[model samples]
Every structure is written in structure tokens, then in C-alpha cells.
Target: MRLNGKLAIVTAAASGMGRAGVARFVREGAKVAAIDISAEALEGVVAEFGADTVTGIRADLLNPDDATGSIDQAVEWLGGADILWAHAGMPGPASVENLDLDAYRKAIDLNITSAALGAGRVAQHMRKRGGGSIIFTSSVSGLVGSMMSPIYSAAKWGVVGLTKSLALALAGDGIRVNVVCPGLADTPMKTGFTGRSGDPAEAAANEAKLIANVPMGRLVQAGEIADAALWLASDEASFVTGVALPVDGGFTAR
Candidate 1:
């Protein structure tokens, strides 16, 4: 309810944290334009949320045009956007030793390039409107070196840098920027983190170990991440910017 009367644009809006954020935003009374790369998933969200409160746009953020276009349409459709969740990113499995040049570039395109473009462009609009909030989805990988997924971790770390600089630069303009670092959340992205395990028992054991490290003794739920996202995008987090808020169940505490 904190976002009542605001309009939000959420990228990666078809699934996981992004999907949860879109739903939370709408439920909190914010109209949202949900963008995702999957046409099928996007259509499904539109069907569930209806066209008025939440609409869907399927586009690859790697395409510069589409990245900017998502912002434009959201601004247009919702009558002016006050919140932007720059959440589109890819987690391609590539080892440093065997990583293909193409895959590495694709990671850069999706994670770093697209996020930078959206941050700059969306900030311009939000600034002109007097004020707004933008939250970038970073990760626990961004905080520490994860050899298991070098490309993804590196890209997420870059997101922290992007969010930090953007927040500092836009502070004067009344536009707030921040980053959310989620730790070991149960999302599709989780499976790819260490490669999918075929054995059910081993996978459960692995999951348990991950939770053991967290002080909270549980993996973060997507809604928990969404709620953090919601507060950052809401007036409740006023005076907050340029910080990476971790909803990691204390994974980073140790």
C-alpha cells in the first residue's frame, strides 16, 4: 500500500524475483509495465494481472532499442513512471577455462550493458518528474568471488558498481538508486548456479548446507526479496540511496 498511486516499470518481470516484485507492486496499488524476454511468460502475467494494472512487454534487454523502449512504454502506459526495477540479467553457465567468447559477451550484454543503459535513461525521466526510485538487482555473488560461476559473479559485482555510481550521481536530482543483493533464493536462477543436480536426495542435502550457513537457517523466499524491493521503491525507504540492501538470511554476515 505504500506505493499507492505510483507507476512502476519492472524488467525480468516474468519470473523469480522480478515476477514477485511485479505482483507485489500491483497489489500495493502501483500500476506496472512488466517486461521480460519470454513472450509466453509475459503473456501469462498479463492474463493474471489484467491489462490495466499490469501489462506485459516481451523484449531482449540486450537490444538497446528494446531496453529504452521498455522504459518509454512504461512511462506512456502508466501515465508517468515513479519506480523502476532494473532487474533483467542472464546467468549463462560458462567456466573461465572453457568459456566461449560469444557466451562471455552475451553475459556482458545482458547484465552490464543493458542495466547501464536503463539506469541512465530511466533516471533522466524520473529526475525530470521531480523524484523517483530505481532499484538494481545485484546478488551475493556480486559481493564475493564465486569461482563456480565467474561470468555471473563478475557481472553482478559490476551491477553494484553501477548502482553505487548512479545513486551518487543522481542524488542531487531527487532520484534515488539502490541495489538489492539476494542470497541463495529459491528461484530458477538457483539451479544454474552450481549446475542442476539430478539426484533428489543430494540436491536436498545441498540446499540444507546452503541454509546452514545463513544465520536465519533458511533460504530467502522470492517474496522476501520482493518485499525489500517494495520498500526501496516505496516512500518508506525515503532518505535511502546508493546502498546495497541484502536479504540473504545473513549469508553475508559471516
Candidate 2:
């Protein structure tokens, strides 16, 4: 077990990449506290993974109190946190032209602000334990412009900046901070962003458009991205820090 005797906290853990990440970490022998905004989904995770291994918490990362409180709750439940994956995110409102100002603010808050807040709170906890790893989920959109979602790209780019600066700030404390820039993945956010209708033909067309651009010729799987997260969280990546790792199947290389 790569993470045996470790305690991990994963945000947005009810579905998609977050859920897969929580499961991956637990499988590596970590006691994980999984957090999501949906209480029902959290309950489902608990039932599927068992309360002994996964502790589920309902938390809205956009809420200031909830953002920091989730870390506190996880520490209380899991005893301590050796790894923190701040991975909650949203697609925001379609394009920049149709961007809802309120939703844009929320998208920024959820994608970047909450990540910073969570990291700060978690850092405090990890400091007592001597050190820990903190990984933030960014996107290939952060590395390149996206005509479909500008605000989301902006927020992810912000994550890259935050991760580097935090790594330097926490280095003396033995903490490592890094960002994962995943390409198009088979996740709920991907479906919500690209899907326009329930029509099968329309869905296939949407997927085809994205696949054509990917160097791998298909969308990445959620578990694949979680694998990157696991490596960053594990001791295998001990010397790695302040990196924007593109788990994007060479999409950004083009």
C-alpha cells in the first residue's frame, strides 16, 4: 500500500474525478474523509466504501465557512490529514459572452478561492504532523485558451499560480504543493459542459469534436486522472513540488 497509515481528505468526492480519487487513496491504504455538496451522494459513498474506510461530509466549497470547516471536520473524523486534494469545481456559465456575473464569481470562488482556503486550513493541520502533500486540480484549459469556457480556464490558471507560491511558502515546513492539469476527462463536468441535448447523435457529435483535438484521440478517464493525484499524494513523489503536471495525454503539447 503506497499510502498505508495515512489520512487523506478529498473534496468533491461524491462523483467524477473526486470520487475516483477518494476511492484510489483508500485503496492505497489511507483512511479518507470524502466531501461533497450533496448529502445523499456522500451517504452513497459511505455505503459503497464503508464508514470505516471513508468518512463522508456534505460541504459546499463555495461557502467561506464550509470551505475551511470541511478541513476541520476531516481532521476530526480522520484523526489527521497527511494528504489534501482540493478538487471541487464547476464549468461556470457556458461562454464568456453569456457569462452570468454571479455565476462567474461563484465559479472563481469554487475553483480557486476555496482551494486556497482549504489548503491554508489543511496546512495548519499538517504542520503539526511535520509535513503533508497538497494537490489542486487544474485543467488543460489553464495551460491554453478555451473558446468554450474562458472563466474556467482563468480560474484553473489561478490554481497553477497558487500551487507554485504555496509550495515555496510551505517548503520549509516540509509540505509539498502541486497542481494537476487534466485534459478532457469522462467526468460529470465534462458531460455538463459539452452536452446540449439528450439526443444520442448530438452527444456523439459533441464527444467527437473533443476527441478530434486530443492527441490520445479520446477523453481521459476519471481513474486515470485519479492515478496522477495518487502519485502526487504518495511518498513516491517525495521530491516533487510546485509542479503543474499535465495529465492531458499530450493535448497541451500540441
Candidate 3:
């Protein structure tokens, strides 16, 4: 019960790392307000966790109003929030060659701006309660460089920068801000993106190529990422802040 009696908000909670975080937190005795853009998927989460343990909120984080409003709603529903996991993001265009500016803007909004807006609103609530934890999801591309998606790399890099700045700004109020930079994970995002080629052989080859780059030779599990987040959000990391921890199977170590 590491988070016994705590309350939390997890965005992108309908699936992947966000859903895993919600489950882990709840198991540790925290009630969660799960926010996602998918109404049907949100309903599924509520069904899986039960209303007593999770409240589902449907809102598109890419919209500034939805981003901030969802945070307010979550805080209000949970009475207060002790943790926030801003995990909503998308893999943008595959390359910069003839890049669509509109796609670039959308990537920035979803990958970084939403986290900023959500964190800003949640920090206000956290201040009233004395302290809290804010976690953002970045990608290994943020720490290094990604040839596949320069726009995504830029946006995730922004998330790391935001986390560090917010940590310093909110440290005095006992708020801890950190980010998790995950490598290629065994999630829909990864498989779906690789499968975009629509050729099984090509998709498999692409996946194999990505895996070969990881020292561990495997995709990082969503549960593993959740465990990292659990520690950061728990009292165990009370003195920790402003760190960009990588759960990338040694991808960044190289």
C-alpha cells in the first residue's frame, strides 16, 4: 500500500502505460480519476476497475480547454490529487521529408502543450494540499535523436525541459516534477506504427530492427514503465524531483 489514502489523476488512461499506472496506483490504495479521449475505452476502464476505484473522464488533451478542464474535474471528483501522470501522446509523422506543418503543430500540442496545461492546473490544487507529484511521459527520442520523427523528438524534448523547470518552480511548495523517457515499448503505439507499412514482412522486419538496437533485445513492457512511475509518485521518492528517468532497456545508456 505505498500510496494508501492517496488520490491520483492519470491521463491517456484508456490503455497502454496510462492504464497500467492507474491499475498499479489503485492496487497500492490510491483512487484514480482516469482521463482519456476515447469515451468507449474510458467506459471499459471504469468497468474493469469499478467506479469506487476509478472515475473516467473523456476529454481530448490536445485541446487546451479540455486539458485544463479535465484536470480541474479530476481534482474536484477526487476531492484532491496527490499525483498526476500526464501520459497522453502520439507518434507524429514518420519523417521530416516534406513534413506537414499541421502534423507538426498537432504533435507539439499533444506531446508537450497538453502536459503543460494539465500540470499548471493540477499544481494549483497540489499547492493547496501542500505537495504533490507530477509525471510526464517522454520518449527515448527526447534524450537522444530520432531519425524517424524529428517533430516527435522536439516535442518530447520540450516535455523534459518543462519537467525540470516545473520541478524547480514548485519545489518550494513540496511539489515534485519528473519525467519518464521510455524506449520502444510493447504497446499499441509501437505495433500500430510499425504495422503502418501494411506488409507483415516489412512490419516484422521494422520491429526486429528496432529491437536489435535495444541492449536488452526486447521491447520494454508497459508494466515496467508503470513501476518506475509508481516509485516516483510514492513517498519513496519524497526527496526526488526534476529527474528524467529512462526506462529504455539501455537505449539511452549508449
Candidate 4:
């Protein structure tokens, strides 16, 4: 119960790492406001976690108002937020040759602006509460260049920058800001983006290629990434801030 008595707000909480983080936070004794764009999915999360431990909010974070609104709603319900996980992001269109300008813009909005905006809003409430922890999700692409997804790489790089800057900005208020960069993960996001096939031969080829660059010989898991976030949100990392911790199975090491 590292996070006992804490209140947290997590974006993109309906699936993948965000959903895992919500569950982890709850297990550690934090009341979570799970914000996602899918109303039905949020309902499912509420059902799984029970209304007492989690409150689901359907919000399109692309709209600036909705991003901050989600945090405000958490404050109203949970009283105030001590842990802010700005974990919402989209891979966008991973085309480099025929760069999709629209996709790039949307990626920036979803991955960079949304995280920064949400963290800023939550920081205010945390400041009033005396202290807090703010965690953002970046990617291994943030530390190194991504050949297949330039726009996503740029957006995640922006997250790292934002986290460092915010850490210094909010340090005086006792708010710690950090980022977690995950390597290829076996999550709904990864499967959806890769279009994983059921064919045995194709699946083998895909798995091989996916782990080729990972020194650890396997993909990271959503739960592992959640553990990193949990540590950052807990008192164990009380003196940790402005750090970009990569939970990427050594992907960025090589």
C-alpha cells in the first residue's frame, strides 16, 4: 500500500498501460479517476474496479477543455489529486515517406500538448495540497530516433522535455515530475498498431522482428511499465524528479 490515502487521476485509463496503472494505483490504495475517450470502455473499468475505488470519465482529450476538465472532475470527487499520470497518447500514422501532416498534428495534440496541459492543471491542485507526484509516459523513441515513426518520436521527445522542465518548475511546490519510456510492449496499443495476425508463420515473423532490436530478447509488458509509474508515484521516489526512466527491456541501451 505504497500509495495509501492518495488520490490519482490517470488519462487514457480505458486500456493498455493506462488501464494497468489504474489497477496498480488502486491496489496500492489510491482512489483513481480513470479518464478515457470511450464511454463504454470507461464503464467496463468502473465495473471491474468497482465505483468506490475508481470513477470513469469519458473525455476526448484532444479538446483542451476536456483534458483539464477531467482533472477538475477528479478533484471534485476525490477531493484533490496527489498523483497525476498523464499517460494518454496515440502512435498516429507511422508513415515517414508520405508524412501525414494531419496525423502529425493529432499526434502532437494527443501526446505532447495533452500531457503538458493536464500535468499543468493537476500541478495547481497538488501545489495546494503541499506535495504530489506527476508521471508522464514517453517511449524509447524519445531517447533515440525512430526510423518508422518520426512524428511519434518527436512527440515523445517533447514529453521528456516537458517532464524535465516541469520537474524544475514544480519542485518548489513539492511536486515531482518524471517520465517513463517503455520499449515495445505486448499491449492492445502495440497489437492494434502492428496489426498482429493470427497466422502462425506471420506471427512468428512479426515477433522475431519486434524483439530483434531488444537486447532482452522480448517485449516489455504493460504491467512492468505500470510498476515503474507506481514507484514514481510512491514515497520510495520522494527525492526523484525530472528523470526519464526507461522501462524498455534495454531497447535504448543498444
Candidate 5:
């Protein structure tokens, strides 16, 4: 168990990469405090994981108070928080010129600001305790330009900056901060983006076409991303910090 005896909170825990990471954390012997905005979906994930291993907290991460609240709740539930996975994020149904301003704000609220709030609390606790690991779910879209997604790209880039800045600021305190940049993974969220095109079959085919461009010629599995998070949270990465490790297969390679 890579995370034996550790405590972690995974935001956006209802589904996709977040859900997978939460489950893997539990399977690796970590006590997890999982958060999601959807009550029903959150319950489903909790049910799937069984009751004895994890505690599910449903909350809107867009609210910084809620982000801070989640940390406190996790500490109360699990005795003490040692790892934080800021995995909550959203792309869009809109292009740059046409995207709703409010939607973009919401993305920033959920993606960037909430991460800062959550990490701040986690760092404080870790600082006092002498050590901990913090992981952020950034994207390849942030590292390379995505002409179709400006706000998401901007927000993800902010995550990279945050990871580096926090890493330096907290190095003296023994807290390590890092970000994971996942390539295209086939998750409910990714599926939904394609399915939204109004033609289900066509949308799926379209998604396939996009995946074919990757050198690996396959979608990155949820578990694969989870494994990266597991490594980041483990002592094996003791000397690692402020790095954006790409779990994208070969998407960024080309």
C-alpha cells in the first residue's frame, strides 16, 4: 500500500479522474475525505467504495469556504489530513469568443482559487506537523496551447504557477507541492463533452478521431492517472516538488 496510514481529500470525487483517485487512495490504505457537488453521484461513488473505507463530503468547491470546510471536515473525520488532491476542474461548452463570462469565472473559482484555499489549509496543517504532499490535477491543455480552450488553458497554467510557487514557499516547512497533467482520458466528463454535440454516435466517433491523434492510439485510463497521484503522494517522491508530471501517454510527446 503506497498510502498506508495516510489521509487524503480528493475534490470532484463523484466521477472521472477524481473518483478513480479517491478509490485508489482507499485501496492503497489511505483514509479519504471525498468531495463532489452532486449529492446523488457522490453517494453512488461512496456506495461503490463501501462504507468502512471512506467518508464522502458533498460540497461546491467553487466556494472557498467550502474548500476550507472540506479540509476541516476531513481532519475531523480521519483524525488528521496528510495529503490533498485538488482534482476538481471543468472545461467548457463554449469557445473563447463565445464562452459565457460567468462560466469562465466559475471555472476559475473551482479550478484555481479553490486549489489555493485547499492547499493553504493543507500546507498549514502539514507545516505544523512537519510534512505532507499536495497534488493538483492540471492538464496537458495547460502545458501546450489548445486553440479551442483558452480559459481552461489559462486556469491550468495558473495551477502550474501555483504548484511551483507553493513548492518553494513551503519547502522550508517540509510540505511538497506538485501537479499532474493528464492527457485525454476517457471519463464521464470527457464523454459528456462529446455527447453534447446532439448526435451521440457521431460524437463518440468524433471523440475517437481525436484520440487517434495521440501517439499511443488509446485513451489514458483513470487508474493510470490515479497511479501518478499515488506516486506524488508517496514517500518515493520525497525529493520531487514543483514539477508538472504528464500522465498523458504520448499526447504531449508529439
Candidate 6:
């Protein structure tokens, strides 16, 4: 039990990597507050994991009030938090020509602002507990350029920068901050993004093109990213901080 006796808060916990993180953390003996904007989906998580191990929190990370309130509520329920996986994020318009200023701002808000607010709020609670770990979800696009969506690439890059800056500022408080940059993951988010072409043939072609770049020759599973998060959140990574760890199957290596 890598996380025995620990308590954690995971945002976007209703699905994908965030939901996987909740399941993995609980299996490792940690009680978790599963925060998501979807109350119905969150209920499903609590039901699946049992109330003893998972507490479902409904909050919109894009809203500052909801973001901070979710952390406060998680701390209240868990007694204290030892880990925070701020994994809520979204893909922006596929091309710069399609970009709208409002959409661009929303991308930044979802990818970076929410992370900053959550980390700040969680750090205060963690400092009282002596130390804790904070993890953010970036993308392979963060490490390299995304010809499809430069805005998303830029926002994710901001996340990596934020992780390093926060790591230094919070180190004296014994808190560790890190980000995970996953390569073309096999998740609904990926499917939906590719499907935006609105033509099944084109969508499949797009996916194939992206996968052709991965040296592993396949999409990275959501669970694999969750596993990386588990390592960062557990005592196994006690000495690790300020790292933008890429679980990108050699995409960035190219």
C-alpha cells in the first residue's frame, strides 16, 4: 500500500485519467475526495468505490469559487490532504484559423488557471500537515509543438512552467509539485478531439497519423498516466519535484 493512511483530492474525477487516479489511490489504501463538475458521474464513482474510500465532490474547476471550495470541502472531509491531482483540462480549437479569443481564454483557464488556484489553496492546507504532493496534467503537446492546436500547446506549456515555479516556491514548505505530459492517450478526450472532423473517415485518418508518430505504435492508456500520477503522489517520489515527466512513448524524444 504505497499510500496507506493518506488522503487525496483528485479533480476531473468522473472519467479518464482522473477517475483512474481515484481508483488507483483507493486501491493503494488512500481515502480520496473525487471532485468533478458532473454530480451524476461523481455519484457513480462513489458508488463504485464505496463511500468509505471515495467522497464525490461536485465543483467546476473553471470557477474560482468552486475550485477553492472543492479543496476546502475535500480537506474538511478527509481531515487533511496529502495529495492533489489537478487533472481537469480540455482541448482547444484544432487550428489557429479556427481559434476564437473567448475559446483561447477558456483553454488557458481550464488548463492553467484552475491548476494555479487549486495548488495555491491546497498548498496552504498541505503546509499545515508539514508537506504534500501536487500533480498537474499536461500533454505531449506541451513539450513539443502541436500543429493541430497551438493554443492548447501553449496552455499546456504554461502548466509545465507553473509546476517548476511552484515547486521552488513551495519546496521550503516541504511540498512537491510536478506535471505529467502524456502522449496521444486512448481516452474519450482523444476520440472526441479527433472526431471533431465530423467525418468518420477523416477522424480515423487523423488518429492514424498521430499514432504513426509514437514509437510504441499505439495510444497511451489512461491507466498508464494514472500509474505515473500514483508514483508522483506516493512516498516513492518523496525526493522528486519540479519535474515535467513525459509519459509520451518517445513522441517528444523525436
Provide the lowest-lDDT 10-residue window in model 3: 191-200
The per-residue C-alpha lDDT of model 3 at residue 47 equals: 95
lDDT to native, each model: 0.86, 0.91, 0.92, 0.89, 0.85, 0.93
**Residue 159 miss distance in model 2 (angstroms):** 0.5
What TM-score quantifies how close candidate 6 is to the native fold?
0.98
TM-score per candidate, in order? Answer: 0.93, 0.96, 0.97, 0.94, 0.93, 0.98
Candidate 2 to truth, TM: 0.96
RMSD of candidates 1 onward, in order: 1.8, 1.4, 1.1, 2.0, 1.7, 1.0
lDDT (tens digit, per residue) of candidate 6 on 141-240: 8989888778889999999999999999999999999999999888878855677768998889989999999998999999999999999999999999
What digit string (tens of lDDT, one per residue) describes model 4 on residues 1-254?
89999999999999889999999999999999999999999999999999998999889999999988988998889999999999998877666678778877889999999998898899889989998999999999899987656788889999999999999998999999999999878887774345434465665576578689888889898999999999999999999999999998888777
Off by over 4 Å in 4: 192-207
Rank candidates, TM-score, best first: 6, 3, 2, 4, 1, 5
Of the pair 3 and 5, which is ahead by TM-score?
Answer: 3
In angstroms, the error of model 6 at 50 is 0.6
Candidate 5 lDDT by residue in tens digits, 158-226:
999999999999988889999999887888767544555578897778678768878888888888998
How far residue 70's Cα lies from its native spot in candidate 2, in Å, is: 0.9
- The CA lDDT at 138 in model 6 is 95
Tens digit per residue, CA lDDT, model 3, 20-72: 99999999999999999999999999999899889999999879999999999
Higher lDDT: candidate 2 or 6?
6
Instruction: List candidate 3 segments past 4 Å from native.
Output: none
